[model samples]
Target: MSAVPLATPTVPRKRRSEAELKAIVDDFNATLAADPEHEPTADEVAAWAAFHFDGTLAVACSMADAVLPHVVSRFAPGVDVLFLETGYHFSDTIVTRDIVAEDLPITLVNVMPELTVAEQDEKFGPRLYERDPALCCQMRKVEPLARTLPLYEAWVTGVRRDEGPTRADTPLVTWDAKNGLVKINPLAAWSFDELLAYAGEHRVEVNSLLSDGYPSIGCEPCTRRVEPGEDPRAGRWAGFAKTECGLHT
Candidate 1:
């Protein structure tokens, strides 16, 4: 039999302890509480995150657009942008991500689940999303992000207050106890009109689905088209009781 290859050793990166991180979170939350209505500019938010978590900061993008990555890169060039490769994305979403990676100044890191799609199907049975979207999302999106987020002290997200009722009260900066990291929502106060204007001004790449009646895009199987008057997020998880895939909450 052929000799088994030796396992590659990994040098652990220095990370803040739970106590230290909790202290920082408490301080930051105090500051946020004092000025609860303070809405910092996107650039200012980026600067604050970079100042505190310079070497251990990351941005999580849903691949719906490159707007957040574009804004963060202004302050932290070459920073890591994590994309959850759930193996169920639309073709346009993947293309948008690839284009952003090729054209932008940031490093695109494709975070993936432990099992491949076929393996998951074999283990959990086919059409897992149809039968149990929450479980599928837990294995594909939530668990993968949980595994990857430990490497960073802070992360930026693209959530906006205008998205829907569920995200209406999104904070600019908050501690994510579930993932044990500081979460930053720089565009928490931005409107859809503002987002579009910024994208036009910056010439940022957006997924084609946005123009096809899908203002909020997710995994293809659960997404559908929405009417003009409906909520932007209504297209996601259509006819289901699921509002989110458990990434934010």
Candidate 2:
């Protein structure tokens, strides 16, 4: 089958007021709550995002898979995809990112931290993630994203409820109080198997680590392999008490 042409986005930059954003969030959350069992089709999810955020919609891809960007490109081609390049990813992660950028119609924006790994190590001592994973994540992931998130009114993520207990209540759409912006998780109801199935069905690019037992890929130093029956995220910060990289928490 021939690939569909990406639609050209014509919506101008339209930043909403605080009250307007709040109203949208409230209404959207209520709608989801009313139909808790309802899982919107990818096309429907893309349509809703286009209707609400329009040109300001950005997809947050972990480079674990290109599923989210593939869905977004149908409605908003050339949309910004926020990729946090924490300077600690595996070679496969970077390769996956490049593959997605080349294959997808979206724009890949590499969000970087204020300091390099060398600078950070020099300032905070070596291997911060080992000593304080939360603070390391704050410096590399959370802080950088928080700075760049203001450019877009709404951001979409690949987070799923089945990933872990902390993410069990993942919503399709909600107000991100931490970043003070509208957050969208279209695949919140999807399971790990569903994600892989979608990728296979759509021929989306997936990280190589997934087949190697790293269900949830993060930085090389912080991420490890998970054994059978372990939570998908168990490999992340394995020894530490940190389940999340603070991007979602």
Each candidate's TM vs. the true structure?
0.91, 0.92
Candidate 2 residues 54-137, lDDT tens each?
A: 788888888988999998887888888878889999999989988888888887888888899999999999999889988989
Compute the lDDT of residue 70 as modeled in candidate 1.
93
Could you tell me how far off, in angstroms, the CA of residue 54 lies in candidate 1 after the best superposition?
A: 0.6
Per-model clash counts, in order, read 0, 0
Specify the poorest-scoring 10-residue window by lDDT in model 2: 1-10
Q: How much lDDT does candidate 2 score?
A: 0.85
lDDT of 1 by residue, 1-249 (tens): 111112110223588887777777677678778987875788888888878777788888988888999999888887788888889999999899889888888877888898899999999999899999999999999998898888788889999999999999998888888998889999999998888889999999989988888889999998999898999988888878888999998
